[model samples]
Structures are given as C-alpha cells and as structure tokens.
Target chain A: MKHIESESNASLKQWKKLHSRKEREKTGTFLLEGPHLIEEAIHSGAKLQHVIVEENYQMKDEWLKERFSLWSVPAKLMKQLSETEKPQGILAVCEMMDQPEDLIKPKGRYLLIDGVQDPGNLGTIIRTADSAGLDGVFLGEGTADLYNGKTVRSTQGSLFHLPVVKADLLQIIGQCKEQDIPVLSTSLQEAVDMRRASEVEGFALIVGNEGAGVQETLQKESTMNVKIPIFGQAESLNVSVATGILLYELQRNRS
Target chain B: MKHIESESNASLKQWKKLHSRKEREKTGTFLLEGPHLIEEAIHSGAKLQHVIVEENYQMKDEWLKERFSLWSVPAKLMKQLSETEKPQGILAVCEMMDQPEDLIKPKGRYLLIDGVQDPGNLGTIIRTADSAGLDGVFLGEGTADLYNGKTVRSTQGSLFHLPVVKADLLQIIGQCKEQDIPVLSTSLQEAVDMRRASEVEGFALIVGNEGAGVQETLQKESTMNVKIPIFGQAESLNVSVATGILLYELQRNRS
Candidate 1:
C-alpha cells in the first residue's frame, strides 16, 4: 500500500479527471465508486487498474487486499474524487469494457437505444435489458454516455454484465435486416399495438428520446413500429418503464 | 391581469413557500410549473387557484385569459418559484387533489407503493399506474411526497389524471381482502415467479423500497408474494420499472 496525502498527487489528479466523459474516453478507463460496484467489477472479471481507499478505511474482504495494490488517500481527497454526495471511502479505476467482437448474432435479442438523454433512464434501460437477457445494447447518437457516474450508479453493476456498444443505429438496423432479425421501433404514430407484435426467435427493439418516440428516420428503417396501448389518461409511459415492458413482452413467450 | 414586480409581494412569498413539503401540506396546495402542466391541470378540471407567468411571457391560449386570473411576476421571481432548470415562464398554484371519497371499490385494480424514497421513481410509478389504467394508488408511509418538485415534474402531468391516496399499507391490504382483490406483495424471498402468477379480474400490487424491498410486515400480511425472475446477472429491477412490468402483465390478459 502507498499513502497519498496531497490533492496534487499525480495519481489523484488523474483519478479525479475520470469524472469527465471526455477524460474517461481519452484515457480508456473510468472510475467505479463505492464497494458494491467495485466488487461487481471484480466478480465480472473486469480489468481493474487500481483500488483506492481512504487512509483510515479498513478492507473488509481479505482477498481484495491480497489481489490488488491499494492506494490510500486522505478523506478529503477521496471525497473530491467521488461523484456521490456521500463518499463511500473506496473507488476503483477500471478499463472501459470492450464491445463484443460479434455485436449481433442470428436469433439474438437486442435493444437499440436512440437519443435517451436522461442518465438515469439510460442506465435503467441497460439494467432491465440485462434482466430480460438481451444479447446486447446499441447506443445510438445523442444517448447519454455509458460511463457517466449517474448512469453507472443507475445500472447497479449490470453495466459489467452485458455487452453495450455505441454505434450508428441505422447501420445496426441494416445488419439486422440482413440477418432476418426483425427491428421493432416504438412510435406513437402508424404503429401496431405492442400486444399484437409477433414474437420471433430474435429482434432488435428500438426505443427513443423522452419526448419524441423513435426518430423518424429510424422508425422508417425498422421492420415495424409498435406502441404500448395507453389504457388511461397518461399520455405515455416513462421511456425506461416502456422499455422494460417491451423487453418483458418480447421475451415472455419465448421463454 | 395583476402585475407584481416585488419579490416580497404576499402572493409571491406564499407561492415560494410551496417549494417546501411542509408548506405544501400546511396550505393544502402545490405549485405546477411550465405551460404543459398548467394546461393539463386546466384540461383535467383540477382546482386551479391562480396562474402566474413572467411579465414578458405572452399567454397563447386566449381562453386561459377569460377563465382565470393571471399574475405577472418578474422573471427572476418566476425562476425563484420554479423547480426546473428552465422555468418556461409560467407556474400555477393549484389545490392538492382530494382522494376519492370511496377509497377502494369491489373488483378495482390498484397499486400500493411502500417506502420508495426517490421522488423520480415515485412519480414514474404513479404515471405507470395511470397508464396501466389502475383504479387508484395508495402511497404507504415512507414513500416520497407526491407534491415534491421532482416528483411533480417526473409525473409529466399524469398527476392530474388519477387518484392517489396516502394511507397505511396494512389497512389497504385489509381493505383489499374485504373487496376480494388479491394483494400481491413483491418480494425476493420464498416468492412465486411473477410470470406464473395468475391474472385476476382485480389486484392490489404492492412494490417496495429500492434496497430493502417490501417490508417484512407487509409481505407477511399480503395474500401472496410474487417476484420477477431475473434471467441475467443483474440482481433486480428498478422499482418504477418493476412496477411497470407488474402492471403491464397484470393488465395484459384482461385487456
């Protein structure tokens, strides 16, 4: 273990920079806050560069002490590095996960995210897609950054469990077409009721921005546009909740 | 139209106090910000006490001018009373809704929320319940205040569409039993798979805290405990999304 008391320490300065999306992308690594997310990363065999903790914090898991080098920093410095209101006294620097070499396969279920600006919604959609056993997620232009602190926290560690890729949604849709995978886009207009959507062996479900449904171009490109029926006065469901219902309906009968 | 430039105007001072939950409860009134929500309130026939707009903002809906008194306040004052980052130059002071005189009816579907602390989750759950056409929602002790700014905004005007009551979960469960409505408590322990749970003519689905889940007491009191099976590495679903899935599944067969 090494002790770093100054805020200007080189490692501390670099770790603090991870708070910015640009910095995380440029460095090819992001910070994981708190013990639970760090433990999940470890369990998922994520590539971790270092584990940092407050100088007075005790490591509860003995294996963690033996497996990784620990950097002990002052409490104030730890707080400076944490994005949350309450610092958990621990953090981990982990490599950005690699997109699966084969982004989509025949007969595989997938989620195509389009311009979901809310970090919380984006993260929950990923977590729900994971729970639904989706093969992967494709982040279209304008979606929140996958490594955003709010998003990572919202995913509740599922970010480590599945493949999430940032790519041109149009290209993905084209590829799915080639593979005979149906692309179902959610839209408020010219759409079939989601209940009537036929389940297939595989699909690429596209859900979009908070106010807008799927972007017009994507809706036009998809095999079909589907919508959850609004049975009451609510204009629409929250995007994340709608995604959850769609994924559940898509997988329910298949299982 | 009444023009008030002073921040200390009695009405302006009173409206600002609505930002606090205590003030909202004490006065039995809450503020709705933005044009969309105000219009929704007007359309829903909610008790709108007054409409306030920034001095420079022009009222587009001519009927709004004829139907209610409008107070024009300074832009800075409007920002002070507004919860969102962008104020949209308008706000409305509305009376808190009255719970339905008859709380629960025979064979009516409902949602019981327990200890969901996040205002966003609570609001989204309420919106989902409305979208699912549930008869009403009972907010158990420990759930976020319905009138909190974030919650009101997250509901996206759905707050005006349905009946939401603050009540004791145990008592609500007892009422459901009397009405022959099965009270399904969502739980992780010794719970039947949610998919296998039979669809009913009416149900009272109780979802709980994000972390601790349905309190032990409520779970024990409910008619049955149900769990959404996780098919992947994620541990659980976001409470709001889980509520959406449960509601969608509960209503899908009946619709």
Candidate 2:
C-alpha cells in the first residue's frame, strides 16, 4: 500500500479542494469519510478512485483488502483531511455518477427540491426518497451541493442508492408535463389538503427552502399545489419532514 | 421598556451563565435566541422572564410588545449573546416549566430517547414528535440537555409545543407500564418490520445514540422491538430520519 505522510501531498491538496462546491463541480468527484460510508459506497458498486486508511489503523477485513486500491496515511494527516472530530480512519474518493436517462424521465414518484440550502436536510430527503422507493430527485438552482461532505454524511450513504440530478426547474417541469407526469408543489397558501389530494401514479412532489415555501414561479407552474394539513399551530414543518410525509403518502396511495 | 448597555451588568452575567446546561438547571431557566423562536415561545404561552431586543430593531408588532417584559440592548450586546452568524436582534430568558404530569404517563404515542448526544438530532426529534402529535418525549440519561442553545434552535421552537422531560430509562419504562403503554425499542438484529408492527394506542418508542442504538438493557426491557426495513443498501438512517419514519407510521396507523 502506498503511504502518504505529508500535508502537502498532491492528493491531499485535491481532497481539500473537494470541500468546496466549485472544486467538486470541476473534478466530478467528492470526498467521503468513515469506514461505514466508504464500505457502503463500495458495496453499492460506486466507482471509487482510491481508499485512504490511517496508517495506525489497519483493516482487519480481508474483503476490504482484496477489493480496492488501498493507501495508508498518518493519523494526523487523516484528521486534517477529515470533516469529523474523530476520524474513522478510512476515507474514499469516488467519481460522480451521471444521472441515468431512464431514471431522469418523469415517472412514478419523485422529489423536486428548489433552494433547499441545508446540506443535512437535502441528504435526509434523498435517503427518505430512496426508502420510500421514489424514482428519483431533481434539484433546482440554489440547492445545496449534492456532493457536500455534510450532505453525504446526512444521507447515511443513500447517495448511491437513487438517481439525484441537478437541473433547471422550468425545463424539468416542462418535460414532466410533456411526459404526462403531474407536477405537485407544496405550499402554505391556496393549497389543497395533501391528504385529500388525488394520489396520481406518477408525480413530482416539490419541496422548497426552510424559510420560504416553493418559489412563486414554480408554484405558479405546478399542475397541483398541495399542503400538508397542520392540526397544530407550527409555522411549518421542517423541509425534510415535509418531504418524508409527502413521500410516504404517495407510496401509500400508489400501493 | 428597560434598557441595559453594559457587558458586565448583573443581568448580562446571568445571561452568559445560561449558555451552559448546568447554569440553566441551577437557575431553572434557559436562553432562547432568534425572532422566530422567541415569537413561537411567546405564542405557546411560555413564561418569559424578559425579552432583549436590539435597540435598532423596532417592535412594531403590538402583540409582542403587549405580552412580554421588553428590554432594549445595543446591537453589540445582542451579538455577544447570540449564537448564529447574524443576531436576529431578539433573545428571551424563559422560566423552565415544571415537567408536566401528562408527559409522564405515556398515552397515545410518545418517544423516549437514550443517550442521544447530538443537539441537532435531539431538537429535530422533538419537533417531529410534536408534529406527529405524540403524547410526550422523555430524554434518557446522557442525552444532550434540551435547554442547550443548539437544541433549542433545532426544535424550530417546537420545544414549547410539547412536554419533554429528562428521566431514567427504567423509571420511565415502569411508568409507561403503569399507564398500560407498551414500550417499543428499535434494533437492527431483532426488530420486525416497523410498518408491519401493530400500533399501540398508547405506547413509547425508544431511540438510542447515533453510534450505538438502544442500549441492550433497555432493549431487553421493551415490550416490542421493531425496525424500519431498508430496501436500498444504505448502512442506516440518521436518528432523526428514523424517528420521523417511525412516527409517521404510527400516525398513519392511527388514522
């Protein structure tokens, strides 16, 4: 196994750049920390560029040893490259997968996010979408970067399970209309009760920013606007919670 | 309106003390920041010791002005007391309400957490429980204090909407039993599919730490063990996400 000890190592410099959205877009790769996430990425058949394990922490599993390109780095160096306080001693660089054409076509249940800035919220929504067996997710402009470290961690490694694509909302909505997929945007005002709304077979449920509901433009363009009935007096549900409820409702209705 | 400008003022020292859980416990009050949260707290009828608004922030809303004891402080003072990047120009000192009796008796549905250390997760869970209309929430030992600034922020002001009490696991379980509420604990190895599990009209769902799930002792004591089945290959759901799914299922079953 190759060993890296210098903070100035070329690969380390590249990993540092992965911390930013611009760098991730430029390289088409993202850094993932911890053994659990790394293992999940490998198991999901994600294209991994390399695996870095802290030199002091050796992998006892023969499976990990046989399957991937392994590199050892000093513990201090690993900490510098990691996002968490206690580095799990394992990290991976994985190539970004292109959104599948079949998955991207508007069909079945999908989540459309507009300007959902919280990385954790974005990741959780993706994981929930996958769990609910949604077809895919589309991200509109100003949404959190899909490959952010916090987003990856929040996904609990579900990032590899489903197709998540970033696209212009106007274009995607137009395509959905062409494909006969209903565009359902969630809003607080002038929205039909989510429970009472018809659960069409194929629909894209759109969620928006925590502070703001869906954009006025998107809301105006939606085929149907629905709101989750709030019996209690909460100003609004968390963006991810709203997504979970809507996804669950869609799954329930379809089943 | 009362105005205080000095950093070393007695009230300022007390406000600074509230930044720690120990201080909150000793004083039987906690500090809440941000306009939205403070507004929610007021709406929920929480007893406010005083509200400190930045001098430049005009209180045009008669409702906020009429209800609470208002104080004005310099912008710098508000910044010093605030946790976020930009102070929202409002902060509150609220008297911690006595743990409500209804919260101790598990009725309908409830959530019990054990050693959940992440403030964000704890806050989100509380908010989820409230939205789902759970009877109450019990914080097991080692969990992050509910009064912490991050925890308060995370609740999105939902902390004021539900009864959250900190207590021992064994005692809480016994109380649930006395109230004839089943205790359901989540685990990977022994859990049946959560969707398939019968919903108890009055029950408590226990979630454990982020790294380690429900403690073995608590698991052994639970009346039912359930798990959310994963269709995809993600390692596990975030604690808050898992809680959301379980609570959603419970609410779904009820209706």
Candidate 3:
C-alpha cells in the first residue's frame, strides 16, 4: 500500500479526473465512494483498479489482497475526493464493463431508459430493475451519466450487478423485435391502461424523460404502450417511482 | 398588496424564519417556492397568506387577485428565502392544514409511515400515496418533518392535497383497529409474501425506516405483515419505491 498525502500525486490527479464523464469514458473507469458500494463492487466481480482508504483505517475484507492496488489517503484528501457532505472514509476506482450492443441477450427482463435527467431518479430506477431481477439496463441518449455520483449513490451499487449498454434505443427496440422479445413502453398519452395490458415475458420496459415523457418515435416503435392509471388528484408520479411500480407489476403477474 | 424592500423588515424576518421547523410549527405555516407548487396550492384551496414575487417578474396568474396578500421583493431577498439552487422568482407562506387527530375519516385508503429518514424518500412516498388515491398519511415517530424544504419539494405539492398527520404509531394502529380497517405493516423479516396478501377495500399500509424496517410492536399490532419478494442480488428496495409498488398493487387489484 502506498500513502498519498498530497493532491499533487500523479496517481491522485488521474483519480480526480475520473470524476469527469469524458475522462471516465476515455479511461473506461469510474470512481466509487463509501464502503457499501465498494463491497458491492467486490461482490459483483468488478475490476477494482484501486481502493483508497483513510489513514490507519482498520477496514479489512478478503477483497483487499486481490488484484486491486491500495492507497492510504489523508483525511483531508479523502474529504476532497468525496462528493457527499459526509465522507465515508473509503473510495475505489473500478473499470466500466460496458458491453457491445450486439452482446445483449435475447431472453431477459430489461430496462431501457431515455432522457432521464435526474441522477437520483435514474439511479433509483436502475436499483429497482436490479431488485426485480432484470437481466440488464440499456441507457439511451440524453439519460444521466451512469457514473454520476448521485446516480451511483442511488443505484446502491446495482450498476455492477447487471449488463449496462449505451446505444440508440430505436435500434435496440428493433433488435428486440427481431429476437421476439417484446419492447414495452411506458406512456401517459394515447396508451392502454397498465393494469389492462397483458403482462409479458422476456421483455424490455422502456421509460422516458421526466417531463416530456417517451419520445414519439420510440413510443411508435414499442410493441405496446401502457399507462399506470392515476386515480387521485395528483397529476402524475415521479419517473423513478412510476418505473418501480411498473417493473414490480411486471414481475408480480408473470405467468 | 405590499412592497417590502428591506430584509430587516420584521414581517420579512418572520417569513424567513419559516425555513426552520420550529418556526413553521409555531407559526402554523411554512414556506413554498416555485410557480408549479404555488399554483397547486391555490388549486387545492390552501389559504395562501402571503405570496412573494421577484420585482418586475412577469408571473401573473388570475389567482394573484384572490384573497392572498402579495409582496414584491428584490432578487437577493428572493434568494435568501429560497432553499433550492434556482429560485423560481416566487415563494409563498401558507398556513399548514394540520387537522385534529379525531377528524381522520373512518374509511379511506391510508399510508402510515414510521421513521423514514430521507426527506426525498418521505416526500416521494407521500406523493405516491396521493397519486394512488390514498386518503390520508399518518406519520409516526422518527419520520422527517413535512415542512422540510426537500420533503415539501419532493412531495410536489401533495402536502396540500391530503391530510398528513403526525401521531403515535401505536395509537394510530389502535384507532385503525377500532374502525375495523386492516392495518397492513410492511416487513422484511417473518412476513407473508406481499404477492399473496389479499387486496382490501379500505386499509392502512405501514412502512418503516429505510434501514430498520418496521418496528416490532407495530409489526405485531398489524393485521398481517407482508413483504415484497426480492428476486435479485439486491438486499432491499428504497423505502419510497417499495411503498409506491405496494400502494399501486393495492389499488390495481382492488375488487
């Protein structure tokens, strides 16, 4: 283990740059903080490039002696590296495991997201998909960056548990259709009520933007569009919450 | 209508104090920001005591001429009173509609929250309960304050649309039993599969803390404890998302 006492360390500079999307994409790696997420990454078999811990931190797990390098950082440096108000005294750098679009399997429950702007909402949706046993998550254009701190925190480390593909959702929808996997889209306008829509197996549930909702082109390409009935005075539900209800419903009634 | 230019003004100071829970509780009012929520408040027929706007702001709705008093403040003052990163040039101080505990109707779908800590999660649960047509929200001990800015914002003005009561979970459970309304407590341990729990006409669903799950006494007091089955590696779901799924399932399958 090496001690990184100053931010001027070349390794620390490269780690700090992982905070940016462009740098993360270029290097094919992202930074993670907190013990829960790092532990989760370890369990998910993510390639842990480095694990940075607070000085004299007694935190030890079997994963410590694995392929990942270790660093003991000063409290000040740890605080500087943390995005949250309260630093949890642990951080890790993990390589992104983005799969090629063609590698996406035909038979699996999946979530396809488009233009979800809020990191919290996107992360919650991903976490929900993970809980529902969805096989993968596909991020369409305009969605929040998968490596965003808020998104990562919200996912609670589910990103490491499933396949994440970034590609044109339109093409993905077509490919699913070719493979006989239904592409189910969520819509609030001109759609069949969700409860009435027939539940399906081996499908991809598509959720869209927070405000404008699923794009017209995407909605048209979907095998079917469904809406969760709003029986109360409130106009609508949050996108993440709506996705949760829908994903669980899909699982609950599977024949 | 009044023009208040100075932050030092006694009334402005009083208004600013509403940011604190103690002050909001003492004054029986709370601060609200953004045009959408303010409009929702108006639609819900909430008593809008004061509406503060940015100087020369073009935000003119016919509700402006209603019984509410008005003040035009400077940008700096608006920023001072707003908790969000971007102040929407509007803020309102409206009385809280805390009903006497006895006024809770005997028959209506309800949500009983116990110790949900995150402001955003608590707010989203309340909003989902509203969208699910739940009549009232009974907030038990340890729940985040409804007047919290993040909580209020996450609710998206649902606070104005329903009765949110903060009371003892034990007493509320007793009252629910007295009325013969099923008190369904959510649990992660020693509970029936939620999918198998029969739907009810009028019932109160109890959800507990994000980490602790439902309290033991509350769980024992419930008519039946139920759990959302987890099919994946995720240990648990976010409290708000879990509540959303439960409420919708309750609503969706009602006879």
Candidate 4:
C-alpha cells in the first residue's frame, strides 16, 4: 500500500477541496468517512474512486480487501480529511453522479424543499423521503446543498438510495402540473388537517423553510394545502418531523 | 441596564460553564441563546436568573424591557458565551426545574427513549413527542442530557411544554404496566408493522438508539414490538423521524 505522509501532499489538498460544494461540483467526487458510512456506500454500489486507510488499520475482513484498491496514509493526514473528531482510519472517495433527468420528471410521491436551510433537517427529510419510497426530492433555492458534510453524515448514507435534484421552485411546480401531478404544500395557515386532506394518486409534497414556510406564490398555486394537527402547547412541529409524518400519512393513505 | 465588561465576571464565567452537561447539572442552570428561545423560556415562566444583551443592541421592544432586568455585556464576551458561529446578541440563564411527580402516572400516549445519545436526535424526539401530544417523555440511561445546550435548542422550547423525566428503565416499565398502559417498542427485526399493531387507549411508544437500537431486555419486556414499514432501499429512518411517524400513526389510529 502506498502511504502519503504529509498534510501538504497534493491528494490531501484535493480531498479537502471536496468538502466545499463548489469543489464537489468541479471534481464530480465527494468523500465518505468512517467504517459504517463506507460500508453502506459500498453496499449501495456507488462507484468508489479511491480508498484511503491508515497504516495500522487491520483488514481482518477478507471481503473489504478484494473490493477496492487501498492506499495507506498517516493517521494525522486522515484526521485532517475526516469531519468527525475521532477519525475512523478509513475513508473513501466516490464519484458523484447527477440525478437522472428522466427520474427528475414529476412522478409518484415527490418532496420539494423550499429554503429548508438546516442541513440536519434537510438530510433527515431526504432520508425519510427515501424510507417512504418517495420518487425523488427537489431542492428549491436557499436549501442547503445535498453534499454538505453535515447533510451527508445525517443522511446515514441514504443519499445513494434516492435521486435528489436541485431545481427552480416555480419551474418544478409547473413541471409537476404539466405531468398531471398535484402539489400538496404544507403551511401553518390556510391549510386543512393533513389526515383529512384527500390523498392524490400522484402528487408532490412541498415542505418549506424553518422560520418562514412555503412562499406565497407557491402556496397560491398549490393544489392542496395541508397541516399536521397540533394538540399540545408546542407552536409547531420541527420541519423534518412534519415532513416525516406527512410522507408517512400519504404513503399509508395511498397503500 | 447594568454592564459587565470582563470575561472573568462571575456571570460570564457561569454562562461559560453551561457549555458542558456536568456544569449544567452541578449548577442546576442552563444557558439559552437567540431571541426566539429566550422569548419561549420567558413565556413558559421558567425562572430567569439573568438576561445578557450586547451593549450595542438597541432596546427596541417595550415588552422585553419590562419583563426582566437586562445586563449589558461587550460583543466579544457575548460571542464567547455563544455556541453558534453567529451569536444572536442575547442569552438567558434559566433555572432547572424538577420533573413533575405526576408524570409517572400515564394518562395518554407517552414516549420512552431507551438510549438515544445524539443531542440533535434527542431534542427532535422531544419536540416530536410534544407535537404528538404525548403525556410525557422518559429519558433512560445513556440518553443525552435534556439540559445540554444542543438538546435544549433542538427542542425549540417544547422541552418546557412536555414533562420529560429520567428514570430507571425497569422501574418505569413496571409502573406503566401497573397503570395498564401497553408499551410498544421499535425494532428492525422481530417487530410487527406499526400500522398493524392494535391501538391502545393509553400506551407508551419506545424509541431506541440510532445505531444499536433498543436493548434486548427492553424489547423482551415490551407489551408489543412494532416496526415502521420501509419501502425504499434506505436501511432505516432517522431516529427522530421514526419517532414522529410512529407517534403520529398511534395518534391517528386512536383518533
């Protein structure tokens, strides 16, 4: 195994660049760290560009040895590349593929996040959407980049399981309408109880920003406006939690 | 307003100590930042030990000025006291209150987190449990401290609305059984679909850790084991998202 000792090494510098969204877009690659994430990424069949492991990492599992080309690096350099406090001694560089254009076409149950800026919330929503079998997720302007380190980590490697596309809010809404898909937008005001809202066969569920909800124009064009019922003193549910309940309820009704 | 300029000031030192769980417990006080959070705490009538504002912060709101005695601190000191990259110019010292004794007596649905450790996940679960109108939340050993800064922030003030208590798992389970409240625990294996599980008039929904999940002993003692149906390739839902869906389903079924 070839070992890169210096943090100033060319490859190490390049790896750090991938942490930024612009660099991830420029290089068409992203970093996956830790054993669990790397294992899940491998299981998802995401193309592995390179695997970097510390010199002392014991590869007791024969399966991992056979799957990829491994390069050894100093533990310190690995820590510099890792987002976690304790570097897991294993990291993988994987190619980032654009979501297929055909799949991005409005179909089945879709989620559109408009300006949901919290990376953890956005990531959890994506994971929930994937678990509920949503067709795809559309990110409107102001939404956190899907490849952000926190977002990727929070997804728990679910990013590879679903198509997440960044698109214009108005444009996507129009496209859904053209495809005969209704847009069910969640709102705090001017919305019916989610349970009582009629479930459309093929519709898109739109979740909005944390502080301000779905935009006025989007709400005006929405085919249905729905809200989760609040029975307690809480002013509102967390955006991600609301998305989870709405998606689950929609899936339940459809099934 | 009285002004304190030094980092070594008694109140500044006390606020800094709130960054750790041990300090929060020892002092029986926690630090809360941001205008919205401070407002929520004040609205909840939680004892306010002190309110710190930057000297440059204009006193724009009459109601805020009337509510508490405000102390002005330098911007540098305010930054030192805040955890966020951008401090919101305000911080509050809140007195910790003991869990309500009556919370142990179940009246409606409740949530029990067996070993959730992530501060964000714990906070989200608490907020979700509150939104679902659950009776209370039980934090088992190994769970993140409820008063931890991140957990408190994540609750979005729902922490004050819900009766959250920490206890011995076995004892709490026994008490629930004595009250005739069924306990439903989540598991990936050997669990029935949450949808198919019979709805109990009064029950407890138990969520486990993000990775290891509920301990075997807790699962065995549960009245029933339930699983949220997953249709996509993603391995599992985020713990908080799962809690939201499960609690909502239970609430939906009962309604």
The TM-scores, one per candidate, come to 0.96, 0.88, 0.96, 0.93
Worst 10 residues of 3 chain A by lDDT: A97-106
lDDT of candidate 2 over B90-193, digit per residue (tens): 88899886767645553657789999999988998898888777767899999999999999998998888878898888888888888888889999987887
Candidate 3 CAPRI classification by DockQ: high
What value does the lDDT take at residue A238 in candidate 3? 90
lDDT of 2 by residue, A1-255 (tens): 789888888988888788888998898989998877777777777888888888877676754644567789988888888888888998888889877874546466678899999998999888888877777789999999989998998888788888899888888788788888889999999998776665577888889998987999999999999987654445667888778777766655443
* Worst ten in a row by lDDT for model 2 chain A: A246-255
lDDT by residue (tens digit), candidate 3, A1-117 = 899888799998898888788998899988899989988988877888999999988776676667888999999998878888898989999888746456456777878998999
Ranking by lDDT: 1, 3, 4, 2
Give interface RMSD, every candidate, in order.
0.7, 2.2, 0.9, 0.9
Candidate 2 whole-model C-alpha lDDT, 0 to 1: 0.82
Clashes of each: 0, 0, 0, 0
Per-prediction CA RMSD (Å): 1.6, 3.1, 1.7, 2.4
The candidate scoring highest on lDDT is 1
Note the residue pairs that clash in candidate 2: none
Off-target runs (Cα >4 Å) in candidate 3 are A100-107, B100-107
- lDDT to native, each model: 0.89, 0.82, 0.86, 0.84
lDDT of 1 by residue, B11-72 (tens): 88998999999999999999988888888887787888888989878777654654667899
For residues B1-255, write the lDDT of model 4, one tens digit per residue. Answer: 889998778977878989998898888999888878777776777877888888888655743644566889988999999898999898888888667775656556788899999998899899888888888899999999998888988998998887899977777887898888888899999888887764567888889998999998999899999998988878898898889888888878544
Over 4 Å off in model 2, which ranges? Answer: A60-72, A104-107, A197-200, A253-255, B1-7, B60-73, B102-107, B189-192, B197-200, B253-255
The TM-score of the first chain in every model comes to 0.96, 0.94, 0.94, 0.92
Q: Name the better of 3 and 4 by lDDT.
A: 3
Instruction: Report clash pairs, candidate 4.
Output: none
Error of 1 at B156 (Å): 0.9
Per-residue lDDT value at B37 in model 2: 83
Docking quality of model 2: it rates as acceptable
